[model samples]
Target: MAAEPAMQMPSLEELQHWTWVFGQAQQMMLEQGLDMMAHMPGPAAMSHLFEPAAAFRATADFWSDTMTLWSRFLTQEPGAPLGEDAEQARDRRFRAPQWHEQPLFDFLRQSYLVIAEHMLKGVDALEGVDARHKEQLRFATRGFLDAMSPANFPATNPEVLEKIVETKGESLLKGLQHMLNDMARGQLTQTDPDAFEVGRNLATTPGKVVRRTPLYELIQYTPTTPDVLKMPVVIFPPWINRYYILDLTPEKSFIRWAVAQGATVFVVSWKSADASMKDVTWDDYVEGGQIDAIDTVRDLLGVESVHAVGYCVAGTTLAATLAVLAARGQADKVKSATFLTAQVDFSHAGDLSNFVDDEQLALIRSLSSDGYLDGRYMAATFNLLRGRDLIWSYVTNNYLLGKDYAPFELLYWNSDVTNLPAKWHLAYLTDLYRDNRMVEPGALSIGDTPIDLSSVKTPSYIQAGREDHIAPPESVWKLTEHFHGPMRFLLAGSGHIAGVVNPPSSGKYQYWTNGRRVKSLQTFLKGARETKGSWWPDWIAWLRGQDGQTVPAKGERIPGKGKLKSLCDAPGTYVRMR
Candidate 1:
């Protein structure tokens, strides 16, 4: 048979040109449609014909306020100061120092603000649309406005113009190369490629992989203290990211810190899912992944019970495992539980819930029909959620200004994403995201047992990031009500990764604790006492209180020395898969 010719990939410039052309076509079509609409009765007039008078009045009032703001801004004297809130607004697009100094830039910025406000109000005023559709429309409109901002274009952006003159066009050339590199990779570059090496500068903490499965590896970190707690600690980090995030550097490693605090720490390093693992599902993860890890920990330590910690999605999985165990009459195997930025209740999963509609899920399923959700696609979704900071800022800095990204460890880990098996991804979206079934009694089942969070009687220490969007603080706080035993919830001062990876030595962020359980998140925040420093110390103290008495440390041994045999070294073969 004759060989089929290989498909040719488009050049970066060709791709960019096509994208520009398509965008221009869409813009023209939209403008023409709006122009046609203008010839007919206007939206306000049409609303009066079909909608309630009160709705029309509200729309008119919004436009009136918008016009008043615009009039004040346009008629203001040249060089007059902006309002305090506008000056202090955290929107980075308008943060160019020149915007405040240059009257033209200031006008453009304020004009964009007014337009965005009106666009959102217009979306809200659409009468026939449901609340969910209205929200999606508003979100889409905001994204469009953000993308069309003058700050993203060299001709309109004062900062880019300044850079062009300063660098004599060299900046633009360098930026083009950076953009091309990102294009080839099919995503935006989040950090400098030359910043850190996996086995050297990052994920360098010493440990040994004591057990291995097709899905994951159990890394038993060497104990640092002369003596350790009688009970061991095992951590289940989310599989979406490499396990090294918990052991990024000796200075900031949560694993290292826990080991140093006289606890035998173990972590699960999930293998990057590929075509070979297409059949892997939530049942496989709970039974084959986490349950196996727990059994291995018990066998290795020769202990009846161990302290378990879960982060993010892994936390969700761990909670389910505990419930499953309780159902099986084996709940005593786990001494206590610690959940970090993990949510069992997906009812209020923050802005991420906005992207979980039926259409989006269908699209994702179609894309991943080959049996895995590509890691790059997942990263892009997350980047889009925080587009201004994660996408456009990089476009402006790396492409417009032609500067290399700074060496950031967290970003490096974030960029190293792992693919998710198709079955597991679909199940997660359907059961947890679409249905919010994890917290509902008997709605979720792993194997033959139905999972229920309320049945898990383990005392839990739950920590939530105040700014977490993936798992909102309120959603995480809801766990206090589900667990049957004592619970302590701590609110940290940063977003997801920052909140979880904070080290006491950094002394950069703070945490809050009311030292009492409260059902309402707002009430908890109102009564919580703010404490400056990492939440690690407070967590370690809490863990110590829950853990058993100290005993002389055992000498380190390879996996083969124990019942669970060896697979590879600490950071593990699975973590290094991709």
Candidate 2:
């Protein structure tokens, strides 16, 4: 047989685009697909049976490459690259020099890549399946392929093998201990969990809890500047996680940064839901969460209106609440709005679209034995989204290499999970994810008010992460059409958390912006120019543009001297909930 021509490979750019949740999602889709397939008796299952010829050809190619790698390894020169350097692979798993310098490890690494690439290409060739299930099968297959990589196990991983020998088997014992500790915690350890805590070192921004409701508590941060903007700012973070992410640490805290920039900041601290809070509906989150926070800010400060900000899930609900306010003739309550990596349209929702279907939603609903869905489960699901980074990487560090995870403020906050009330969770999944009703005006409502997104005329500063897994830039761009206000659509570097939380001091990443609206993200990119560093300063400048009136900072450091009596210190009681 003649030697074959080189296989056409996906560019590193193409591969990097899928990096967000590709590794973890690949596993998540497969595990969930099995159960979902049982209930989803549809043509998607038959998609696998389609394109059999291509699949067979790819399989043969995979085997051929594997055999070639094996044969080459049998007689290869020492310190020589085995066809390709695994170290050069874009994948972090194969970055170890041992993977490239050692022939056997290099073979294992290349063989795995060959298999994964072929499998992914074969999935792309699949036909006859609906687009949705086709994607599901693709991710599921990738998950399986990713999980079986030689680098995941100590025995097959040269780096891990070296660590074992260096420590004379003590590494193995420590790995078992780490595994046991994680087991006791009932979740995989991503960082040193004990190293940080809310208020003590994490959410240490000085502030006061001004308002508390059954659903949420509003924290009003003390001003770092003598005079604060007349229009105060209220932030509603996703109920799926705590609000402290915005206030992680002084240097990194967006909340702290905003206050120092002469803006009074109030953040919604959602009380983690429990069985007692099961009946809380999505409307409650709107009325009691964002709306209530807005109302509280106005009441506490004696201001007519304030600037509003929403993040992720809260951003979606913030838009929905704006729609409701529009319907109720109270849109003026919010002077302006800013959305951080938020979506108004789901049409372009990337890999996440696979998880929401009739069967899967029902299956998820069934898992909530209590009135609320455990935040831990949602956390795990999210971890699976970036499984290679959030899950497997830790497995290698804490278990395989028997090394301690560095004390990271962000990872600690990421580890903290919050539950979702059953009603709100189901409604969000069904109305938003399954049906994408947010884009369809009047298709959804809060309480009695119809959620007519077109009626939302509040000016918006919408910022999206170019690489956000939760809110793709395309989906966030769709938000421009939904709001009638003059909008600024910003495309920032990095993903959800890092992009929005980026502070000016650290000086990482960049952002793209265009004054004029474009037909699509691709078109927008053509007209946009990249500005290096954080989007925070641009956002602050915009905040100043909206009602730039300044007043002496209202709430003083004295406990009883402020206009509104302090309820508690910042990182309030609600966020402290498990």
Candidate 3:
């Protein structure tokens, strides 16, 4: 028998063109079918056409206003600006040269805006479909309109056209090369990689690896104060990214700031997973990872209790660990719990939850045959949630205008991704995102014990980002109901990472707190008082009150002094791995 012929693969450009062609065809079919149904001569047809009729009316009104603005501009009469509300335009890249100023470009931009609005309204007006389907439809519709925006094309984009004219087409050639390089790498080039070195410039806060585990390394930051608080702090950051996000540069380092405030700080730096660690489960993380870190901190400080902090997914894990400890009659292990933008209830998890249905979950499992979900895949999903900012803006800058990516610390941290273990990822999706079992009593288990958040009863401090897309403030507020102990909830004015990493020295954003618990999130917000500063100072003050009493500082305590011996320097061996 003859050998089988080799299969051919489509280029990225070819794939994109084909996708657009298919979308156009589907849109045409839908429009034609709707038109046919509208013309049918029967009462049932008219009844069935109510939503489409409303959508048509709305579209007509939108276009009528658009035409009136154009007519005024052509006749040289004073008229309202086409794109007057800059805040409504979510994509910043459209603010490039002459897009809002030039008549022709402004008209194009406004036309796209009107169409997008109509599309969203049409999705909302659909009567028969369930909420989940409607959400999916809205998401897909927005993605299509975003792709069709004139600003994405070099020929139609004013800024890209000007760049070509200025550089005599050399910029376009460079941009093409950049686009090709990014396509080959399977990710957008978000920052200039040559500008940063991890240890020297990025994760530079001084510290040492006090202990190492199969899953993580415990880093004890060098104390910066003369006398430290008796209670130490152990932070568990989400393992999806490196722990350096909390230690990114001295000015913004949370660990450094906490140490300076007279607190001994330790952070768990998780290992990037590979096939060898595929069998690790949620139980292993709670018991062997977080609980073990608590034990190490107690031994190192010669104290019984320590303050426990967790960010994002790690926050959920920390809550589960606390419940497990409480079940074992070790409730005093954690003196207090702090959660940053963490969600105990996943019912209202924002746009991220739209991609977590049964079909998508199965697809993810099939793709994780290597025993881990690839970091690139996770990054792509997040970028899609804010495609205009995280995806296409980079596209226009790197591929159309031929501009080098600026060196940004936050973007760099975002690009420094880590693989998640396949087993743990699946369990997290099924238990938390899909079933939302974390908030329910005895629905989730760790080791041999079923975890229950209501039984934990540790005093808690929770912070939620006002603009967080991953874990919305409404979802975070649900934690108040689950925790039986005293709770202080804060609403910070930024997105997920920025809200948590905010330093008081910056004097940038504001936070809100009512100092009184309420049953509803909206009610809490309505009664909350706006304070002009970062929430970090408030947190530090609260922590100080909980610290019991002051003690003599262990100046630059070496890692090898504790029962858990030193494995390496700060940032450890696992963080150094790819």
In terms of lDDT, the best-performing candidate is 3
User: What is the Cα-based TM-score of model 2?
Assistant: 0.90
lDDT of 1 at 21: 47
Off by over 4 Å in 3: 1-52, 62-78, 81-86, 89-91
- Clash counts for the predictions, in order: 0, 4, 0
Task: Name every residue pair that clashes in candidate 1.
Answer: none
Candidates 1 and 2 compared: the better one by lDDT is 2
lDDT-best of 2 and 3: 3
Please provide, for model 2 over 1-578, each residue's C-alpha lDDT reduced to its tens digit, 9 standing for 90 to 100. 99766535445564444333333443354344434433435653453454557756755665566556555655563433322445335678888787776655666676566556655666677666668877877766766666777778887899888889889999888988999998897888888877898888889988888777888887877777878888888898998998888988788989888888888888888899999898898888888778877886787677899899989988998999898988888999999999998887888787777778787788778978788888887888788777778888888889888997789988888888888898879888888887888888778778778888888889999999988987888888888877888888899999989988899998899999987777678889999999999999899888888788898864443223566678888878998888
Error of 1 at 148 (Å): 1.7
Error of 2 at 396 (Å): 1.5
Per lDDT, what order, best first? 3, 2, 1
Query: How far is each candidate from the true structure, as Cα RMSD in Å?
Result: 9.4, 8.1, 9.2
Q: Candidate 3 residues 1-578, lDDT tens each?
A: 99866535456565456445433543563454345334433223433534757777866765576566555545436555543356656557576658777655665666566556655666677676667656766776776666767788897799999899889999999999998998898888899977876788877777788888889999987777677888889999999889989888888888888888888889999999888888989988898899999997887778899999999999999989889989999999999999999988898888888788777888889989989888888888988998878888788889989998799888888888889998999889888998999988898889789988989789899999999999999999998988899889999999898998888898979999987778988999899999987999999888887775777665335355556566667877787776
In model 3, how large is the Cα lDDT of residue 132? 64
Q: Locate the minimum summed-lDDT window of 10 residues in model 2.
A: 18-27
lDDT of each: 0.78, 0.79, 0.81
| TM-score for each predicted model, relative to the true structure | 0.87, 0.90, 0.89
Please give the lDDT score for candidate 2.
0.79
